[model samples]
Target chain A: MTGPWAEALPWVIALPLVGAALTPAVAVRRPRAAGFWAWGVLLVTAVLAAGLVSELLARGPFSYELGGWPAAYGIELRFDHFSAWVLPLALLFVVIVPFSWRYLDHVMPDERRPPFYALLLLNAGGMIGFCVTGDLFNLFVFTEVVSLSSYALVAVGGRGLAAFAALKYLFIGAVSSLLMLFATAQLFVLTGSLNMAEVSLRLAEVGGGTAVMVAFAAYAVSFMVKAAMFPVHVWLPDAHAIAPSPVSAVLSGMVVKVGIVGMLRVYQIYYGAEVLELGAFNLALVWLGAVSIVMGAFFAIFQDDIKLMLAYSTISNIGYIVLGLGLASPYAVIGASVHVFNHALIKATLFLAAGSIIHQTGFRTLSDLRGVARAMPQTSAAMAIGAVSIVGLPPTAGFVCKWYIALGAFEANQAPFGFALVFGALFIFIYYIRMLNAFYFQKPVHAAVAQASETPWSMRGPVVLLASLCLILGVLGGIPLTFVEPAVLDLLPLWGP
Target chain B: MLLFGLDLDYVAVVMLFCVGLYMLVAKSNLLKKLLGLNVMETAVFAFIVTAGMVEGGDPPIMVAGTSAPFASPIPHAMVLTGIVVAVSVTAVALALIVQIHAHFGTIEIDELKELP
Candidate 1:
């Protein structure tokens, strides 16, 4: 029997692809209409995504095979807690599209608007597709789709450094994708099946060999680069800095987290079975995460550009997620998953607010943007809310995930990592305080800031919405923790008794 | 079937991957770097396509009446999709290089750094 959830599942993937196609065609005739059109489409996708989430909540996790074909031969799209990310992913796009309405006209020329929105929609669809698919090769295809669109989106920042940054991003991103494909090939060669469930079953039988370990390394490094973990995160700061504001929000907020989602899936496939020994790998993740947490915050403090600082902070936060996942305790997994969700909201709010500041004031650096709060009170306030949450302060979203991770670290007897998380939070706090000092205490340093106006309502609205969400989700941590706990249990049942 | 005590095809894949990676890292020219990326992509594709090979096997296409071990077609299909992706990336990259040249007047990564 066909259920409503089944009817709606494919539409979540289909609607945006359809909308992305129609955008440029609409733009050819009515260029001004493209932004509103995309917003409408994303709004529909958001509703469908929410429906999927509610259905999953009511019915538990389920998989839908495409085209009436069985899962082994055909593509399977799963709607477990991991894929439930489609809800927030789609809603984030809904927030970003309206923000782009005025921001695009403010930054770039008129002719590029339609194509810009098209790429944005396409990127969103790719990410949602990436999360929901259960087949291994489909993961690679969607990752490529997201990367190709992101390269274009980064390049669309209007000449000069934008093109170079996009090209560099392309080179690094392409190599990472190739590595992942190589890894996928290895898994296929070993298991003779590309479906994740089947491969997981087969990998258990022929496990613990040199070739398998090599494939594991390949997948780890490939996904780490995508997550923008410390060492390979060179491409992020410049790319995010040069991109248009809404694009920056989307990239920092959602796209990078897609990599973390990939890691979660990888862990499920490889770690769920007892054949592979992850002791060394998990320890490596813990230490690498420790280094990332400290080093990323250290680098972030030195960045003068607002978006660049936010970008570096992303690496640091990714460290926390990785650390928690490495611990492999039930609490740690829940913390990692919640942090993944929390950081997306906090960073998106921060980036969008920063974009608004740059939009109204034309200041890119803190030294030039002193006393921005006086002119753009709402935007700066939203930025402060994001900053508080990101710093893991009390009564905000960031604190909840950090708390769980800290408890998990101690429970797992990884006290050093627990301390690292604490020290890292202190370091993050210092820079955010510095930022606040620049915003409120210091006088307007540049002539542009002195003449700046408040951000438009269309832009200000989403920032406010996300900022408040940071508080609401923080106070109600159990909402996401509910979805997170079961998913973690299914993958890693090591937290016995 | 083997050279230097290693499978020849696998050896070739490793050499190609390393050479491509080296050029990507060491080369300063934008076009050369893209070339390196293409080489790396090709090497990965080669490894994948070779995995589908069987000893003394025929192509997967079925004849009227014959029983023979056939090479797997799945990897071949995957490689075809990969080749198209590689081409699209290369086309976009070359276009970006053109734009970079027009804007900064140089295609060398070092010289672009010197531009104001």
Candidate 2:
């Protein structure tokens, strides 16, 4: 809350990084000890993270030059409500990461557990760095930090299909990262400053240029690829399906949401109102968001594998964010933004719950899970809450996000997009209802059922807690939206009375 | 025909970027695709160094008798981070590729997908 703590901003990225480095040092001493220590480190980080967010909110948008130098002369790290929100989620993922270690150990061989936790912590660092840094090149470096670690994580979970899938993901992530770096270089050439604020200022001076638009497109496409938007989403289902459940949850919840955040940051900073208005980027966003909604749903319905079904469903839900982005209005953008927070909580819960079932029963196919309800009532209950929230049902966080997006669409006079909103809701119903029905009605009699008892409390507790939060946040939504609304208003043209 | 004495350096870097991007897009081999990515990254690094080079700029590192910080030091520092990232990616990518080989017994994209 003090005036700029220039030295401290990078420490937000550094805390988890230092924790990651120390993880193996401690873990190698005693494998069991590593998990508890990791959780404590992450928990302290979550507290520190809360302090930073409060500081950022009080002071307004804050930038710390990485060293003592002025922002334009050094890599600048900036934080507002946007990056502020992303940092905590990354930290919380670290908090719950140990529970996942227990779950993954059951599914993976002994060799992977230590490395997986190490990669997970490193990823926490990378994701934080990506969100907090205001320097364009730093953003690219952190993107690699997350990607390379994620690719390794994916390989451990999947074998033949997963290996190939990881490769595809590697290719896509590599290409996008290259495009991102190139775009950053282009900006550097034009502006002579890698600092985001200065870049925006200089670009405004140059104004309406081919190179800027190309750079914008490059950022947007890269973000979309990472977000797993439909069409560009070829590698996603296989990747998610093959990944161990915890990895799947993290990939779906934290990893992809980071991409959406990145794109929004790019637009708000680089494009702003001046270039955004000229580009009509809103129209283009709406266009893709619309297609991704319907197409993702259609694809989701055809998947026999439950994870694949959820994977496709993830693509559909991301469309809502895309649509909200396309709406580019304050309320709509808020809808999209809040949806990331809301959906990440709900989706992670569902995947963890589903993972509990998978770890217990070794069954992922829908047909294979006939009556899992009787065996693991708690996981099933969490899944139900997650499914309900995801469907935008009452008293769940998903509803608030949908309500805003719908209002945004109608407000924008984009009725068809409004229709797409409702249709997306219906698609949520079609797939999730089937999932629920399968859980309740389908008999759980597969061969994996004998070993498929419920997971221990460590694994189930995080899912349950998040599911409960989904319920509570939906009903008393004013608190969460307080941060989101202010952020959203900053992006809007027609905001305020 | 050259704009500056540095024209060839710029052109060569641009060509490397194009070649790498093409291989990244067009190549079917997974290893080559990753190689292309590294190639592209190096090309970008080269271009960035060129941008930092002014008419009389010299190496960024300050040593004995090195005065006045002739070249842009910022880009050089940034490239150090970039190179670290490149190496990290290459290590992870090659590791994943090796695992893929163990599982599918081939590194070719077409061959891996042929089963499913």
Considering every candidate listed, which one attains the maximal DockQ? Answer: 1
TM-score of chain B of each: 0.94, 0.84
Model 1: share of native contacts present? 0.56
Misplaced by over 4 Å in model 2 are A1-8, A272-279, A447-452, A494-497, B1-14, B60-69
Compared with the true structure, what per-residue lDDT tens digits does model 2 show for residues A1-497? 46544345677678777877877777775666666766776676666677777776677777776667888877788877787775548555854675686786766765556677777777777888888888888888888888887887777776666777787888788778877877887788778888887888888887767878777888888888989888788878878878888888888888887679888778766655254443366787787888888888898888878888888878888989999888866778888988888888888888888888877887887788878887888889989999999889888988999999999998888888898889878987898888889888776677566335778888877878888888998989777687787777776653221
Which has the greatest lDDT? 1
Model 2, TM vs. native = 0.93
Per residue, candidate 1 scores C-alpha lDDT tens digits across B1-116 of 79989899999999999999999999999999999999999999999999999888888887786458888889998999899889988987888888899888899999998877
Residue pairs with backbone overlap in model 2: A360-A452, A361-A452, A370-A442, A370-A443, A371-A442, A371-A443, A371-A444
Candidate 1 Cα errors over 4 Å, as ranges: A494-497
DockQ of predictions, in order shown: 0.77, 0.65
Native contact recovery (fnat) for each candidate is: 0.56, 0.73
The model with the greatest TM-score is: 1
Evaluate residue A219 in candidate 1 and report its C-alpha lDDT on the 0 to 100 scale.
89
Candidate 1 lDDT tens digits, A110-197: 7788888888888988898898899998899989889999999999867868899999999999999999999999999998888998
